[model samples]
Target: MEKRTLGTAGPRVAPIGLGCMGMSWGYAESRRDDDTSIQVIRRALDAGVDLLDTAAVYGDGHNEHLVGRAIAGRRDEAVIATKGGLVVDDLATKQMHRDGRPETLRRQVEDSLTRLGIDRIDLYYLHRVDPAVPVEERLGRPRRPRY
Candidate 1:
Protein backbone atom coordinates (compact mmCIF):
# COMPACT_ATOMS: atom_id res chain seq x y z
CA MET A 1 0.00 0.00 0.00
CA GLU A 2 1.18 3.52 -0.72
CA LYS A 3 2.04 5.61 2.33
CA ARG A 4 2.31 9.32 2.99
CA THR A 5 2.60 11.80 5.85
CA LEU A 6 -0.68 13.21 7.08
CA GLY A 7 0.93 16.63 7.45
CA THR A 8 4.32 18.28 7.62
CA ALA A 9 4.90 16.76 11.06
CA GLY A 10 2.42 13.94 11.35
CA PRO A 11 2.61 10.18 11.32
CA ARG A 12 3.00 8.20 8.13
CA VAL A 13 -0.14 6.33 7.17
CA ALA A 14 -1.71 4.41 4.32
CA PRO A 15 -3.13 6.42 1.44
CA ILE A 16 -6.58 4.95 2.05
CA GLY A 17 -8.59 6.03 5.06
CA LEU A 18 -11.60 3.98 6.11
CA GLY A 19 -14.78 5.89 6.72
CA CYS A 20 -16.59 3.95 9.43
CA MET A 21 -20.00 5.47 8.91
CA GLY A 22 -22.35 3.00 7.23
CA MET A 23 -20.99 0.26 9.38
CA SER A 24 -22.92 1.49 12.41
CA TRP A 25 -25.08 4.16 10.89
CA GLY A 26 -26.47 5.51 7.64
CA TYR A 27 -28.05 3.55 4.76
CA ALA A 28 -29.34 0.13 5.69
CA GLU A 29 -30.19 -0.13 9.37
CA SER A 30 -30.80 -3.87 9.19
CA ARG A 31 -27.20 -4.45 8.18
CA ARG A 32 -25.37 -2.88 11.13
CA ASP A 33 -23.16 -5.46 12.75
CA ASP A 34 -20.81 -4.68 15.61
CA ASP A 35 -18.78 -7.87 15.44
CA THR A 36 -18.22 -7.71 11.73
CA SER A 37 -17.40 -4.02 11.83
CA ILE A 38 -14.81 -4.61 14.51
CA GLN A 39 -13.37 -7.48 12.52
CA VAL A 40 -13.15 -5.37 9.40
CA ILE A 41 -11.34 -2.57 11.23
CA ARG A 42 -8.78 -4.95 12.63
CA ARG A 43 -8.34 -6.50 9.23
CA ALA A 44 -7.85 -3.07 7.73
CA LEU A 45 -5.13 -2.31 10.23
CA ASP A 46 -3.50 -5.61 9.46
CA ALA A 47 -3.71 -4.69 5.80
CA GLY A 48 -1.92 -1.31 6.39
CA VAL A 49 -4.92 1.02 6.64
CA ASP A 50 -4.32 3.18 9.72
CA LEU A 51 -6.77 6.02 9.45
CA LEU A 52 -10.40 5.45 10.51
CA ASP A 53 -13.03 8.15 10.11
CA THR A 54 -16.19 8.48 12.19
CA ALA A 55 -18.49 11.24 13.33
CA ALA A 56 -20.58 12.01 16.41
CA VAL A 57 -23.78 12.46 14.42
CA TYR A 58 -23.42 9.03 12.93
CA GLY A 59 -26.01 6.93 14.77
CA ASP A 60 -25.89 9.60 17.52
CA GLY A 61 -22.46 8.37 18.69
CA HIS A 62 -23.02 4.67 18.04
CA ASN A 63 -20.35 4.70 15.34
CA GLU A 64 -17.68 6.05 17.68
CA HIS A 65 -18.51 3.44 20.28
CA LEU A 66 -18.10 0.80 17.62
CA VAL A 67 -14.74 2.29 16.62
CA GLY A 68 -13.65 2.38 20.25
CA ARG A 69 -14.39 -1.32 20.53
CA ALA A 70 -12.64 -2.11 17.30
CA ILE A 71 -9.40 -0.36 18.25
CA ALA A 72 -9.33 -1.31 21.90
CA GLY A 73 -6.37 -3.67 21.70
CA ARG A 74 -4.70 -2.14 18.67
CA ARG A 75 -5.10 1.52 19.48
CA ASP A 76 -1.45 2.17 18.79
CA GLU A 77 -1.85 0.96 15.23
CA ALA A 78 -4.93 2.97 14.31
CA VAL A 79 -5.21 6.72 13.77
CA ILE A 80 -8.82 7.47 14.69
CA ALA A 81 -10.49 10.60 13.35
CA THR A 82 -13.91 11.78 14.57
CA LYS A 83 -15.99 14.90 14.03
CA GLY A 84 -18.10 17.08 16.31
CA GLY A 85 -19.92 20.48 16.17
CA LEU A 86 -23.10 18.96 14.71
CA VAL A 87 -25.79 18.39 17.27
CA VAL A 88 -28.50 15.87 16.57
CA ASP A 89 -31.91 17.18 17.50
CA ASP A 90 -33.90 14.31 16.06
CA LEU A 91 -32.24 10.93 15.74
CA ALA A 92 -35.14 9.33 13.92
CA THR A 93 -35.31 12.08 11.32
CA LYS A 94 -31.57 12.76 11.42
CA GLN A 95 -32.09 16.46 12.00
CA MET A 96 -28.88 18.25 12.94
CA HIS A 97 -27.64 21.76 13.67
CA ARG A 98 -24.20 23.33 13.77
CA ASP A 99 -22.70 24.55 17.07
CA GLY A 100 -19.09 25.72 16.80
CA ARG A 101 -18.99 27.84 19.93
CA PRO A 102 -15.97 27.03 22.09
CA GLU A 103 -18.18 25.84 24.93
CA THR A 104 -20.21 23.60 22.67
CA LEU A 105 -17.10 22.26 21.02
CA ARG A 106 -15.59 21.43 24.40
CA ARG A 107 -18.66 19.56 25.53
CA GLN A 108 -18.78 17.69 22.26
CA VAL A 109 -15.15 16.70 22.63
CA GLU A 110 -15.76 15.33 26.08
CA ASP A 111 -18.70 13.27 24.87
CA SER A 112 -16.64 12.00 21.96
CA LEU A 113 -13.76 11.03 24.23
CA THR A 114 -16.01 9.10 26.56
CA ARG A 115 -17.81 7.32 23.75
CA LEU A 116 -14.59 6.48 21.92
CA GLY A 117 -12.95 5.19 25.11
CA ILE A 118 -9.79 7.11 24.31
CA ASP A 119 -7.87 9.76 26.19
CA ARG A 120 -7.00 11.82 23.15
CA ILE A 121 -8.28 11.98 19.60
CA ASP A 122 -5.92 11.87 16.63
CA LEU A 123 -8.00 14.26 14.54
CA TYR A 124 -11.08 16.26 15.50
CA TYR A 125 -13.16 17.80 12.75
CA LEU A 126 -15.94 20.32 12.95
CA HIS A 127 -18.86 18.58 11.25
CA ARG A 128 -19.89 21.94 9.86
CA VAL A 129 -19.59 25.69 10.36
CA ASP A 130 -22.25 27.42 12.40
CA PRO A 131 -23.69 30.53 10.85
CA ALA A 132 -23.99 32.19 14.23
CA VAL A 133 -20.31 32.07 15.10
CA PRO A 134 -17.40 33.45 13.17
CA VAL A 135 -14.83 30.84 12.23
CA GLU A 136 -11.98 33.00 13.49
CA GLU A 137 -13.71 33.58 16.82
CA ARG A 138 -14.39 29.89 17.21
CA LEU A 139 -10.79 29.02 16.48
CA GLY A 140 -9.11 32.01 18.14
CA ARG A 141 -7.35 29.85 20.68
CA PRO A 142 -7.67 26.44 19.15
CA ARG A 143 -5.05 24.83 21.35
CA ARG A 144 -6.24 26.52 24.54
CA PRO A 145 -9.57 24.75 24.79
CA ARG A 146 -10.09 23.32 28.28
CA TYR A 147 -12.18 20.35 27.23
Candidate 2:
Protein backbone atom coordinates (compact mmCIF):
# COMPACT_ATOMS: atom_id res chain seq x y z
CA MET A 1 0.00 0.00 0.00
CA GLU A 2 1.29 3.43 -0.89
CA LYS A 3 1.59 5.62 2.18
CA ARG A 4 1.75 9.41 2.52
CA THR A 5 2.11 11.73 5.45
CA LEU A 6 -1.03 13.61 6.43
CA GLY A 7 0.93 16.84 6.85
CA THR A 8 4.62 17.54 6.95
CA ALA A 9 4.93 15.52 10.16
CA GLY A 10 1.65 13.74 10.68
CA PRO A 11 1.16 9.98 10.62
CA ARG A 12 1.80 8.14 7.38
CA VAL A 13 -1.35 6.56 5.95
CA ALA A 14 -2.51 4.99 2.74
CA PRO A 15 -2.98 7.46 -0.06
CA ILE A 16 -6.62 6.47 -0.29
CA GLY A 17 -8.83 6.68 2.78
CA LEU A 18 -12.28 5.39 3.64
CA GLY A 19 -14.89 8.09 3.93
CA CYS A 20 -17.51 6.62 6.26
CA MET A 21 -20.24 9.24 5.84
CA GLY A 22 -22.44 7.30 3.45
CA MET A 23 -22.19 4.23 5.63
CA SER A 24 -24.13 5.78 8.50
CA TRP A 25 -25.92 8.79 7.00
CA GLY A 26 -26.73 10.51 3.73
CA TYR A 27 -27.68 8.69 0.50
CA ALA A 28 -30.49 6.12 0.72
CA GLU A 29 -31.31 5.32 4.31
CA SER A 30 -33.17 2.21 3.34
CA ARG A 31 -30.04 0.63 1.94
CA ARG A 32 -27.87 1.46 4.95
CA ASP A 33 -26.54 -1.63 6.67
CA ASP A 34 -24.41 -1.54 9.80
CA ASP A 35 -23.08 -5.05 9.28
CA THR A 36 -21.89 -4.29 5.78
CA SER A 37 -20.37 -1.00 6.80
CA ILE A 38 -18.44 -2.66 9.58
CA GLN A 39 -17.18 -5.32 7.22
CA VAL A 40 -16.12 -2.75 4.68
CA ILE A 41 -14.16 -0.79 7.25
CA ARG A 42 -12.47 -3.93 8.51
CA ARG A 43 -11.58 -4.93 5.00
CA ALA A 44 -10.07 -1.53 4.33
CA LEU A 45 -7.97 -1.84 7.46
CA ASP A 46 -6.87 -5.33 6.52
CA ALA A 47 -5.86 -4.07 3.09
CA GLY A 48 -3.57 -1.45 4.64
CA VAL A 49 -5.98 1.43 4.14
CA ASP A 50 -5.62 2.78 7.63
CA LEU A 51 -7.14 6.24 7.34
CA LEU A 52 -10.77 5.98 8.43
CA ASP A 53 -12.61 9.26 8.08
CA THR A 54 -15.77 9.91 10.09
CA ALA A 55 -17.45 12.80 11.85
CA ALA A 56 -19.48 13.51 14.96
CA VAL A 57 -21.95 15.39 12.80
CA TYR A 58 -22.35 12.31 10.67
CA GLY A 59 -25.48 10.61 12.01
CA ASP A 60 -25.14 12.75 15.11
CA GLY A 61 -22.34 10.53 16.38
CA HIS A 62 -23.91 7.32 15.06
CA ASN A 63 -21.15 6.98 12.46
CA GLU A 64 -18.44 7.36 15.08
CA HIS A 65 -19.99 4.58 17.12
CA LEU A 66 -20.16 2.38 14.03
CA VAL A 67 -16.49 3.07 13.25
CA GLY A 68 -15.63 2.35 16.85
CA ARG A 69 -17.30 -1.03 16.68
CA ALA A 70 -15.63 -1.85 13.38
CA ILE A 71 -12.13 -1.13 14.69
CA ALA A 72 -12.70 -2.72 18.14
CA GLY A 73 -9.85 -5.20 18.56
CA ARG A 74 -7.89 -3.85 15.60
CA ARG A 75 -7.59 -0.29 16.79
CA ASP A 76 -3.86 -0.23 16.24
CA GLU A 77 -4.28 -1.15 12.61
CA ALA A 78 -6.32 1.94 11.76
CA VAL A 79 -5.69 5.67 12.00
CA ILE A 80 -9.00 7.17 13.10
CA ALA A 81 -9.90 10.61 11.72
CA THR A 82 -13.08 12.33 12.83
CA LYS A 83 -14.56 15.83 12.76
CA GLY A 84 -16.44 18.02 15.18
CA GLY A 85 -17.59 21.70 15.44
CA LEU A 86 -21.10 21.09 14.17
CA VAL A 87 -24.21 20.59 16.27
CA VAL A 88 -26.93 18.48 14.76
CA ASP A 89 -30.27 20.24 14.77
CA ASP A 90 -32.36 17.40 13.40
CA LEU A 91 -31.31 13.82 12.88
CA ALA A 92 -33.93 13.08 10.26
CA THR A 93 -33.09 16.02 8.02
CA LYS A 94 -29.40 16.18 8.93
CA GLN A 95 -29.69 19.88 9.74
CA MET A 96 -26.71 21.17 11.69
CA HIS A 97 -25.28 24.43 12.93
CA ARG A 98 -21.63 25.34 13.34
CA ASP A 99 -20.67 25.63 16.99
CA GLY A 100 -16.97 26.24 17.45
CA ARG A 101 -17.28 27.73 20.88
CA PRO A 102 -14.61 26.51 23.25
CA GLU A 103 -17.12 24.88 25.52
CA THR A 104 -18.90 23.24 22.63
CA LEU A 105 -15.67 21.97 21.09
CA ARG A 106 -14.56 20.63 24.46
CA ARG A 107 -17.84 18.80 24.98
CA GLN A 108 -17.93 17.52 21.41
CA VAL A 109 -14.39 16.14 21.64
CA GLU A 110 -15.20 14.28 24.82
CA ASP A 111 -18.43 12.95 23.36
CA SER A 112 -16.68 11.84 20.18
CA LEU A 113 -13.97 10.09 22.20
CA THR A 114 -16.62 8.27 24.21
CA ARG A 115 -18.60 7.29 21.15
CA LEU A 116 -15.50 6.06 19.32
CA GLY A 117 -14.41 4.16 22.42
CA ILE A 118 -10.93 5.57 22.12
CA ASP A 119 -8.75 7.29 24.67
CA ARG A 120 -7.28 9.66 22.07
CA ILE A 121 -8.21 10.47 18.51
CA ASP A 122 -5.42 10.24 15.94
CA LEU A 123 -6.78 13.15 13.94
CA TYR A 124 -9.57 15.54 14.85
CA TYR A 125 -10.99 18.04 12.38
CA LEU A 126 -13.21 21.03 12.87
CA HIS A 127 -16.17 20.34 10.59
CA ARG A 128 -16.90 24.00 9.97
CA VAL A 129 -15.92 27.34 11.39
CA ASP A 130 -18.61 29.12 13.36
CA PRO A 131 -18.96 32.69 12.14
CA ALA A 132 -20.46 33.71 15.43
CA VAL A 133 -17.31 32.77 17.29
CA PRO A 134 -13.92 34.26 16.61
CA VAL A 135 -11.59 31.80 14.92
CA GLU A 136 -8.84 32.10 17.51
CA GLU A 137 -11.16 31.58 20.44
CA ARG A 138 -13.08 28.81 18.73
CA LEU A 139 -9.86 26.94 18.06
CA GLY A 140 -8.84 27.55 21.71
CA ARG A 141 -5.25 28.87 21.81
CA PRO A 142 -2.47 30.05 19.50
CA ARG A 143 -2.95 28.60 16.03
CA ARG A 144 -3.74 25.10 17.26
CA PRO A 145 -6.19 24.01 19.90
CA ARG A 146 -4.91 22.94 23.29
CA TYR A 147 -6.52 19.53 23.09
Candidate 3:
Protein backbone atom coordinates (compact mmCIF):
# COMPACT_ATOMS: atom_id res chain seq x y z
CA MET A 1 0.00 0.00 0.00
CA GLU A 2 1.36 3.37 -1.01
CA LYS A 3 1.35 6.19 1.52
CA ARG A 4 0.99 9.91 0.96
CA THR A 5 1.31 12.91 3.23
CA LEU A 6 -1.98 14.50 4.14
CA GLY A 7 -1.68 18.20 3.40
CA THR A 8 1.77 19.68 4.04
CA ALA A 9 2.09 18.84 7.73
CA GLY A 10 -0.56 16.23 8.36
CA PRO A 11 -0.06 12.52 8.94
CA ARG A 12 1.02 10.15 6.23
CA VAL A 13 -1.79 7.87 5.13
CA ALA A 14 -2.50 5.19 2.56
CA PRO A 15 -3.52 6.33 -0.91
CA ILE A 16 -6.95 4.89 -0.32
CA GLY A 17 -9.17 5.52 2.68
CA LEU A 18 -12.10 3.44 3.91
CA GLY A 19 -15.28 5.48 4.10
CA CYS A 20 -17.60 3.87 6.66
CA MET A 21 -20.74 5.78 5.73
CA GLY A 22 -22.21 3.12 3.47
CA MET A 23 -21.60 0.43 6.01
CA SER A 24 -23.79 2.08 8.62
CA TRP A 25 -25.93 4.43 6.54
CA GLY A 26 -26.14 6.26 3.23
CA TYR A 27 -26.82 3.42 0.75
CA ALA A 28 -28.99 0.36 1.04
CA GLU A 29 -30.14 0.85 4.61
CA SER A 30 -31.91 -2.51 4.47
CA ARG A 31 -28.57 -4.16 3.74
CA ARG A 32 -26.70 -2.57 6.63
CA ASP A 33 -24.78 -5.40 8.28
CA ASP A 34 -22.69 -4.57 11.28
CA ASP A 35 -20.75 -7.81 11.40
CA THR A 36 -19.80 -7.62 7.74
CA SER A 37 -18.88 -3.97 8.05
CA ILE A 38 -16.62 -4.65 10.99
CA GLN A 39 -14.91 -7.44 9.09
CA VAL A 40 -14.41 -5.22 6.10
CA ILE A 41 -12.89 -2.48 8.23
CA ARG A 42 -10.56 -4.95 9.88
CA ARG A 43 -9.55 -6.30 6.50
CA ALA A 44 -8.82 -2.80 5.32
CA LEU A 45 -6.62 -2.18 8.32
CA ASP A 46 -4.77 -5.42 7.75
CA ALA A 47 -4.23 -4.34 4.16
CA GLY A 48 -2.55 -1.13 5.43
CA VAL A 49 -5.43 1.17 4.77
CA ASP A 50 -5.12 3.64 7.63
CA LEU A 51 -7.62 6.41 7.01
CA LEU A 52 -11.21 5.75 8.06
CA ASP A 53 -13.74 8.42 7.21
CA THR A 54 -16.97 8.81 9.18
CA ALA A 55 -19.37 11.53 10.29
CA ALA A 56 -21.90 12.26 13.00
CA VAL A 57 -24.72 13.00 10.55
CA TYR A 58 -24.38 9.56 9.00
CA GLY A 59 -27.21 7.58 10.51
CA ASP A 60 -27.33 10.28 13.19
CA GLY A 61 -23.99 9.08 14.59
CA HIS A 62 -24.41 5.35 13.88
CA ASN A 63 -21.45 5.36 11.50
CA GLU A 64 -19.13 6.72 14.16
CA HIS A 65 -20.23 3.98 16.53
CA LEU A 66 -19.66 1.32 13.89
CA VAL A 67 -16.23 2.70 13.07
CA GLY A 68 -15.41 2.86 16.74
CA ARG A 69 -16.25 -0.81 17.15
CA ALA A 70 -14.26 -1.74 14.07
CA ILE A 71 -11.16 0.03 15.31
CA ALA A 72 -11.50 -0.98 18.92
CA GLY A 73 -8.31 -3.02 19.33
CA ARG A 74 -6.46 -1.44 16.43
CA ARG A 75 -6.59 2.22 17.30
CA ASP A 76 -2.90 2.72 16.59
CA GLU A 77 -3.31 1.25 13.14
CA ALA A 78 -5.97 3.70 12.06
CA VAL A 79 -6.34 7.41 11.39
CA ILE A 80 -9.90 8.11 12.36
CA ALA A 81 -11.33 10.98 10.36
CA THR A 82 -14.77 12.27 11.25
CA LYS A 83 -16.84 15.38 10.65
CA GLY A 84 -19.09 17.68 12.65
CA GLY A 85 -21.07 20.96 12.36
CA LEU A 86 -24.03 19.23 10.68
CA VAL A 87 -26.97 18.39 12.87
CA VAL A 88 -29.44 15.77 11.67
CA ASP A 89 -32.89 17.20 11.11
CA ASP A 90 -34.38 13.93 10.00
CA LEU A 91 -32.52 10.66 9.81
CA ALA A 92 -35.18 9.11 7.61
CA THR A 93 -34.93 11.89 5.07
CA LYS A 94 -31.19 12.53 5.57
CA GLN A 95 -31.89 16.19 6.19
CA MET A 96 -29.42 18.24 8.24
CA HIS A 97 -28.38 21.81 8.92
CA ARG A 98 -24.97 23.36 9.43
CA ASP A 99 -24.15 24.73 12.85
CA GLY A 100 -20.64 26.10 12.97
CA ARG A 101 -20.92 28.12 16.13
CA PRO A 102 -18.14 27.50 18.61
CA GLU A 103 -20.51 26.10 21.18
CA THR A 104 -22.11 23.78 18.67
CA LEU A 105 -18.71 22.57 17.48
CA ARG A 106 -17.60 22.02 21.05
CA ARG A 107 -20.67 19.95 21.77
CA GLN A 108 -20.37 18.00 18.55
CA VAL A 109 -16.69 17.27 19.16
CA GLU A 110 -17.42 16.03 22.64
CA ASP A 111 -20.28 13.91 21.35
CA SER A 112 -18.17 12.51 18.55
CA LEU A 113 -15.41 11.68 21.00
CA THR A 114 -17.90 9.81 23.13
CA ARG A 115 -19.49 8.00 20.21
CA LEU A 116 -16.14 7.02 18.67
CA GLY A 117 -14.84 5.83 22.05
CA ILE A 118 -11.56 7.57 21.42
CA ASP A 119 -9.54 9.95 23.54
CA ARG A 120 -8.80 12.15 20.56
CA ILE A 121 -9.80 12.21 16.94
CA ASP A 122 -7.01 11.90 14.38
CA LEU A 123 -8.73 14.32 12.02
CA TYR A 124 -11.82 16.47 12.30
CA TYR A 125 -13.66 18.13 9.47
CA LEU A 126 -16.55 20.56 9.33
CA HIS A 127 -19.25 18.57 7.50
CA ARG A 128 -20.81 21.80 6.32
CA VAL A 129 -20.01 25.48 6.84
CA ASP A 130 -22.79 27.64 8.18
CA PRO A 131 -23.06 30.84 6.23
CA ALA A 132 -24.58 32.56 9.20
CA VAL A 133 -21.33 32.19 11.07
CA PRO A 134 -17.90 33.37 10.04
CA VAL A 135 -15.53 30.60 8.98
CA GLU A 136 -12.83 31.93 11.26
CA GLU A 137 -15.12 31.59 14.24
CA ARG A 138 -15.55 27.91 13.46
CA LEU A 139 -12.03 27.03 12.32
CA GLY A 140 -10.01 29.55 14.26
CA ARG A 141 -7.85 28.79 17.25
CA PRO A 142 -9.80 28.12 20.37
CA ARG A 143 -10.25 31.23 22.44
CA ARG A 144 -10.33 31.25 26.20
CA PRO A 145 -13.99 31.20 27.12
CA ARG A 146 -15.06 34.52 28.57
CA TYR A 147 -16.71 33.43 31.74
Give the runs in model 1 whose Cα sits over 4 Å from its true position. 144-147
Residue 44's C-alpha lDDT in candidate 3? 96
lDDT (Cα, tens digit) per residue for candidate 1, span 60-82 = 99999999998997888888889
Give candidate 1's TM-score. Answer: 0.92
Task: Give the deviation of candidate 2 from the true structure as CA RMSD.
Answer: 2.3
Estimate every model's Cα lDDT from 0 to 1: 0.87, 0.89, 0.89
Q: Which residues of candidate 2, in runs, are more than 4 Å off? A: 142-147
| C-alpha-based local distance difference test score of model 3 | 0.89
lDDT of 2 by residue, 1-147 (tens): 988988777788999999999998898867889999999999999889999999998888889999999999998888989988999999998898988899998898999999999888889878987889998887666444222
Specify the poorest-scoring 10-residue window by lDDT in model 1: 138-147
Off by over 4 Å in 3: 142-147
Clashing pairs in 1: none
- Weakest lDDT window of 10 consecutive positions for candidate 2: 138-147
